[model samples]
Target: MPHHPAPEETLPVIALNGPTASGKSTLAVDVALHLAAHGQPAEIVNADSMLVYRGMDIGTAKPTQAERRGVRHHLVDVLDVTEVATVADFQDRARTAIADCRRRGVVPVLVGGSALYQRAILDVFEFPGTDAAVRARWEARLADEGPEALHAELARRSPAAGAEILPGNGRRLVRALEVIDLTGSHAATLPAWTYAIPGVRAWGLELPRDVMDARIAERVDAMWEAGFVDEVRRLEAAGLRRGRTAAVAIGYAQVLRFLAGEITQDEARADTVRRTKRFARRQLGWFRRDDRIAWLAAGDPGAAATIAHDALGPDALTTDAPQQRCGGGEQAHGQRR
Candidate 1:
């Protein structure tokens, strides 16, 4: 690591963003290696909210030690399943991590499937203040009348927020209702684009819709084969059911229902795939609104090279690196959908 950062006011943050099953982990590793080998040291900082929880490895598709390829990753597996992962908290920690890496003169590679999290970090996004009483009231109503009832109220209050949040998402509905009640309006589910720092570039990778859908299904199938049910079973034993955020995670939620005899295994698998694909589409839609992103087709040859050059510039790899830093070549080239 460098003893001091370069004399820039702000370092550029390279972002690898895509939907579920987009293979962002593999692509990010490849990009990091390419940067390191060329004299620009870089490290990955996870932006996915789900990736924060430990014991969520298989379902979240977290990279194993082998897949990390010796690169240091920040903000991955830093939270227990019982701890809540909120955007405000994540924003502070992620900003600190990015600043730390920049202080060491290492590029911060932001990668995740959560579009909201990404926008919160890179853009001038501030969360609405929450009131305990307001939240409690909405949560109680959600428990009594169900999520759809509150969702209807949200729709009546703020049509935009209502259209964005899913009706089945009781947690989000409660939050939205609370925000509307206290603030007189609810912001859109995803933040509007307004980057906080200059030169922060997001690269969007996507496949054809059909291929992406198939991959989501296949990934969910692989998770079950890899004992996802067993993993969730262990977590439930460890009190995952009591965890607000972890309990509602994509595969974990569905599988937990299956384990409780609320649904069949096949239903769990199908719902997992369906919800994941829906999430992917939403991610793509959210990213599409950001005109600064340089969209790239997934599996494109030399795409990693493109991101590396765009991030570090042509002189970074060719010219001698600035005084400081430890550092790679490309490995696997997978991307998120």
Candidate 2:
């Protein structure tokens, strides 16, 4: 297979985004290999927030080195466990990586579950400036009243932000409230879903609700079997508890509780499964809102080929005008409705 045209010659990015356990990583490698065979060499640029941290291999479901099939990957294992991952920081780094890949005459396949991070890279979105005092106040309130109380307060102030943020996600909840306090609103004031970067299109991997739930359960079970707790223990020694963002990753949070003896192993397992399913559902909801994404069923054998066709075929993948809202044309390709 010949390498696809250079970035200037064609689309610069093919984003493979989906919920956890949707096989995006495998599909990304498959797409890259397929592209390379066609002479369109491609590399993977991770967009997952947690995957940026090193020593977070198993629980984050990070692809193994062998699984990469010798394809170059960017943005994985770049941060120590003590570092914080911010969307703005990620946007700068990921965009730079994508550009670097293009300069090297390779396609940059951006893949991950973080909707906002993906958007920050591809959309004309800017984060609100944060005030130290405002953030501190909200952080202190979170410590005092707990996440549930603060989330309720946030719901009262900004219903949209509240609905979008998980109650247990104290960090994000705090940030949302902080944004609200600083900007007088959250999310509403930001730019609508519009691709700021040219030559990019997102393909979403989806499965039936039952299939997705099963995948989540199965993945959680495999995580335990793969010694996810042991992985967490190693990361804790690397100062995971001090790492604001990495410490709260789904499995890490649960395992931390288990390590602290706050919960039994069985309880941790059960909670991890339940929280993962809920997180997956939330992920679907977030991705579903972006009409620009072309959905493809995860179970379809032809899904990867369809994605390749969409990216490399004659049809020009277009985005709506920046001023236009994204509320239409969200049809899933290569799957039954």
Candidate 3:
């Protein structure tokens, strides 16, 4: 009901958002370490969508346990691949993590490059509730008339919403239409719902287009070498299919095609590279449209940490001296297990 405090009004939840393979994870780790060295320890919360799915480690670029570097991390490997984890779900989880961190007197450092997921956690966006009948009708139409025709219809009915929903994202398009049809309001015009817990600031990481492309290519090659193909095979063996959300993760999908004999390894690698580049472009476009984020150019993790510390203040990091938890008392990472 009430509005959440703006960035300047709160304790400071630092966010590091960027495209995939732009070094957000490594940067986040470095930032956390810097905070620790300053006697202000920070906890890393995963904002990546795919990383939340269990068994998606390699392709998702999930930080290795050792790479976590004694810093507390939350929200990774929290979901089953078969389970549907929506933005709303992530909002609730991330909000809880932020609150818990702040309560403990530790700064919550949100990290990852999943634009939609990150925005869902940091900003106020209301996802339209689903209606089975409406969804079935739209899906049937989507199947019969195809995505282009359905996109056209959406454009006719809700131009603003259509502008945001890509034709290829059938689920989102249908959801938008459902919102308009059910609520008699355009999805794009939906009011921001307050998820604001005090003390949150979002930062965006950016890199030159050429550099980002090269990084993407290199990451893809590393993934392949790190048993990415076997990861896809394991998912398939677990009964995951191509059209499923988990299977559609950029690298996973392309690698799956290769393993299935649908494309050569070279073609798959090239396709993955191209898709990753396109995804990065979309990420930049999405973040650029939002004015709230404080942008930092990629490279030199220490510089990013310094910028975050400056923007958020020295208190944003929790020092080892004595820290509090969200509800009360000190809560250490891995204390639950």
lDDT of each: 0.80, 0.81, 0.72
lDDT of 1 by residue, 1-337 (tens): 6566362335668888987877788989998998888788889999998889999999999999999999989999899999888888899999888888888888889999877888888889978899999889987898799878888888888888877777777878888888777777776445667777555767878789998999999998899899899999999998998887888888898999899999999999999998888888977887877766667777765667777866765455333332111111111111211
Worst 10 residues of 2 by lDDT: 320-329
Evaluation by TM-score, superior candidate among 1 and 2: 1
Write one digit per residue (lDDT tens) for candidate 3, span 177-228: 7777888777543445343444455566778899999998999899889988
Q: What TM-score against the true fold does each predicted structure earn?
A: 0.90, 0.89, 0.81
Q: Where does candidate 1 have its weakest 10-residue lDDT segment?
A: 323-332
Q: Is candidate 1 or candidate 2 better by lDDT?
A: 2
Which candidate comes out best when scored by TM-score?
A: 1
Candidate number achieving the greatest lDDT relative to the actual structure: 2
Superposed model 2: Cα runs more than 4 Å off = 1-9, 188-190, 315-337
- After TM-score superposition, the amount by which residue 57's alpha carbon in candidate 3 deviates from its true location, in angstroms, is 1.6
Residue-level lDDT of model 2, residues 1-337, one tens digit each, is: 9888656546558888988899999999888876776567889999999888999998888999899999888999999989888888999999899888878878899999878788888889888898999889988998898889989998999888888788998888888888888878897435787777667768888888888889988998999999898899998888999998998888889999999999998999899889889988888888888877887778556555556555554342333111111112123322211
